[model samples]
Target: MRHYFSDIFLRKAVIALSGLLMLAGGAAAREFTVNTISDEKGNARTPVISDTGLVAWQAYSLHDGDTPVHQRVDVLSAPPNTRRSDIIIWQDGKTNNLTATDTRLTGRCEQPVVGGNAVAFLAWFKNETDLGMPFTLSIPDKTDEMKQMESDYPTLFDPPKPPPVSTVEAEAGEAAPPPEPETPEAAATNGLNENLQRQMWRDSGQAADIVYYNTARGQLERLTSGNRHYCSPVVSDAGVAFQCARGWPYGYEMVAWPASATNLVQLTTNYYYVLHPDLHGNELVFQGWDGNDYEIFRYRFDTGQMEQITNNSFDDTAPVVWDGRIAWVGYPTITAEIFYWADGALRKISERTEDNTAPSIWEGQVVWQAYDDTDMEIYYFNGRRTIKLTSNTWDDLAPQIRDGLITWMSYVDNWDSEIMAFDLSDNIAVQLTNNEFEDSYPQTAGGKIVWQTIGAEGSFIQMAVPAAAP
Candidate 1:
């Protein structure tokens, strides 16, 4: 019995020791040194890593004795463990070249050091009467000891191999293959034949406020010209409505043009500013500003009669009609509020604390831009309750809803503004543009979105198509 117990205890000890050995072997760390090829001038380069961890580099060459030469080189770095370095070269008044070299340099020390992982070596020479270009790098493999260390860690010094060349070809006597034909579904989805969102913007050109049209042709059409100052163009199947301002105090006269006619019919003779004209069936809902305040008004095309919808002393604007309700922005107090005209009664939707503007009604929900303690954000009211859509600290405004999706423009940072869309049902927001330029005032209709892109060339309308359903 004592011998059997000793045998069991020894087996247990052996099993515990083997488990610890395996754990230690798995935890052992690895060190690697990466080497890159130098240009013809013996200048090595470093690599650029993307957000996805992929690396890429371009090849460059040097000239020797007035003759051009070529060579292949690559930039490399460790996966994600250490700080990556960059190389920059300046010539004349501009940056002529930028590269990442294989040397790591220390601060406050100009001379190169031996046996350091990061060492920079600089070379300077004169060409004829001109001063030679100066080169600085960090990874100097000067001695055989450092060279042997690079050889032991082959991965660090291993250069990227060239892509394999293909030699397979079609037979000499074989006929060329026929081109593939397009499918009906693909043609319909990709073709520019469907109706898209159409809105107007003021171009700060000689033709101040031009009636801009965004169509299926993927281009903007300027309809009016020369000092007319046409603004606020809204389109429907029947026609387009606009406010043409000419003189002081920005006196605007409401006008409508049939889709087939070039001439516009002056709908209102008043010199007040009329804006935010939306067409529903044959009726038009717009906001007209007298010398004092703004009021929501409606016009019946068949009857040729204009009637005021809200007779309150507050400012009401941004009228959007959907599901037999006209949604607009009304300021009962100092804060801008949201109100909808339904069943011949006016009902307020948003809370009184926040200032709401740019209300759009679609699919039984009212979406608008509101400001709380922070910058502008988007909020939606579904008849019973209001919910904030975005929680970022930046400004997000100009909410437009179409086909069960809410599209808005958000400033991700001080310099980056993007167009984003959110599916109301699934509560999923998708970033559409990741550009550095400012993209704002996104309006969606049907399967497309149009926005104003503010870049170096000034503001212009840009369009984006929605992804097809999977």
Candidate 2:
């Protein structure tokens, strides 16, 4: 039987962090600090960290107090929409609210992916403006008999109506006075204003499109526009690759925005439900439906060609690309397994019967989580041997590897999770966080790791630097 061990459980049971720790056998002792990058007002989540120490994430802020009250009847009973999402970036001890600075971005902006100094994300209006047309609730006109009934039974038909309440007032438990009837001129002006507002929302540069911060020009640029949804953008040396909905029958197609270029290229016209695209260098990889099952597909930006890497009955999805190699999850039977494609050859690296998914590839190494009949465990492939990096009762998920350093999130319970890391060269595993808060979704890059922590106050982005071995 293979001996299994958990660093998190062992560290918590044995070692108590007192600023530093001394290791046995004269091994190097590690010391590091966890720094909070986001403020408490907005609950930050899903942070993306680049090699350049630039961190980007999505955060939700409280809605403004003075919200406009439309005269429409539906607006009176609509549920409160009191939170708005914005993309935030932190770099070099400075924080910038990217969505707040841009006047045109007037809705929920999220799903930020940072590469180098640039950040790419998706932004769309959260209001009726995203409908792309003026939305009007059709209220049936009351018949003459209804009007007579109201006139005859004034007490029952016309009870005192409560005043309309704004979101702030409702939260504060305060009642607001009803507004007076609008004049004909005021109604006309309001209608014109509504149309202008809709137009501005629709024409808001890159609404429902791929928006990215241009490092060269120091401004946000819209990669694609029009009324369509783009999903799962991945950044690389070539540029960004994402799946875009091309309407019905067409489904979704893969699109790419070349680095430092204004022109957009549609890499796939099949539009067969492409999802979770990953880009590295000039090669873009993703899983596309092929009528039978999902298969792995790769597109080369330099050659303008598409290649189908896998063609089995099983569904192969969530491909992550690095250099020219790709790693993903494939179901050989009823259980999922880790699969890899490199040097024009495909191989199943995982030998376990349990489910293995969310594979991350860097250089030639791959890391992912696998089920071991009890809970999830982290597994790794160091280009030769398959190694189990984590073995614990808790579920270890979202393993990311970069330059021989592997990071993952281990959950002690449904609401308690922590970040753990393993160094390949030293063959040492370390628990990076030990606190009451839930730390998860660890992403490693350029020897630096970033993750989000959820606490009672709010979720925040945190960065940790692992000390080098002495």
Candidate 3:
């Protein structure tokens, strides 16, 4: 390899600046530190960490005395799991509180996902605004009502007076309230990355629409709407892919969009439902029902080529794609086991399936939750062999991997949980949190971990990193 002076100088400078130095071919041993992102007044949970060290979370702040009435989401840089002091919650720019108050905020926005550019969620808004060209529900005319009544009725002469109109019926066709001018903070981060394609949802139980936020152009473009449910959206640098349902089984089809929702692409519109899309540049992998059973499929964006990954008579689900390799749960013999697909070949990763599920892959390495007959443990795979990483009786679930760092949740119970991480470089897995609090939904990326912990005060997001970095 040719050595350039500027490249060598920059490499040294980056090592000095980030305080991270690695040996030639061995893994580096790292101590971990946890950083609190939100606490006290509100709860911050559902955080996602990007491979570049950026973190975003959804929080409910108790702006009032004890009620967490102020709901918002925030994103900040936490490369080394640095604690953020100047945190600002981002909300829709509608100043009339429609986005905050009147809308029936559902779990649609509950999925707080982050990628390279911005944080996205399912924004459930079901208020007067989205009700569409409103109409009055006026009482029937006096003469028309009297004639409609049967002559046999003795009370036909005495017309019943109309009761008070309901708040919803009365406000029909009412103009929306004027919004406040752009606040200094709102204008700054309104559409942080107007070019990055983001998937979001607007579900109100009765009605919903799946949409994508165009970061480069700052537009929330709708992909599908009208009496339907859509979810589990995954996006790559190329486009966004999600699953939609139109009630029953017709709605669960895999759909895609490039930069704008207007350029909508329905990858699968068959009778079977396609769910849980995993998108990684130029490739989209998901599992869908193929008439009789569920199997995994992959689609190439550049050439519009589609291929079935698994053909067995089992349910292949929850696939996560990284680069080109894919990992998912395959239910062979009805016993769920971790499986992988690479180089046109599908193979099982687990030695024996005792209910193994929730597999995630990064650069061909896999991690998953498995039950070794009695205890629930998280397992790891090095693309060659499999090993049980944890031997605890306590349940360790939802293990994620990135850059050799593995993270998962250790729960004594549902509310009493902890975030644990293991570094492949040093072959050391340490409990990142050990206290009287609830920490779960851990994700690993860029050699760092992010998760949420709920205490008496409120739920907060905490990040961990190898403690050697300054």
Best by TM-score: 2
- The digit string of per-residue lDDT tens for model 2 on 211-294 reads 778456677766665456677787765687777775433467777877876666777665357788887778888889987799
Question: What are the Cα lDDT values of the candidates?
Answer: 0.51, 0.71, 0.61
Inter-residue clash pairs, candidate 2: none
Predict model 2's lDDT versus the native: 0.71
Clash totals for all models, in order? 15, 0, 12
Q: Which ten residues in a row have the lowest lDDT in candidate 1?
A: 107-116
Decoy 3 TM-score against native: 0.69
Query: Which 10-residue span in candidate 3 carries the lowest summed lDDT?
Result: 10-19
Local error of candidate 2 at 233, Å? Answer: 1.7
C-alpha RMSD by candidate, in order: 31.5, 14.1, 16.1
Question: What's the candidate order when arranged by decreasing lDDT?
Answer: 2, 3, 1
lDDT of 3 by residue, 412-456 (tens): 443477777666676655666766877889987788787877766
**Candidate 1, residue 419: CA error in Å?**
2.6
lDDT tens per residue, model 1, 219-249: 2223343344555555554555666664432
What's model 1's lDDT at 262? 52
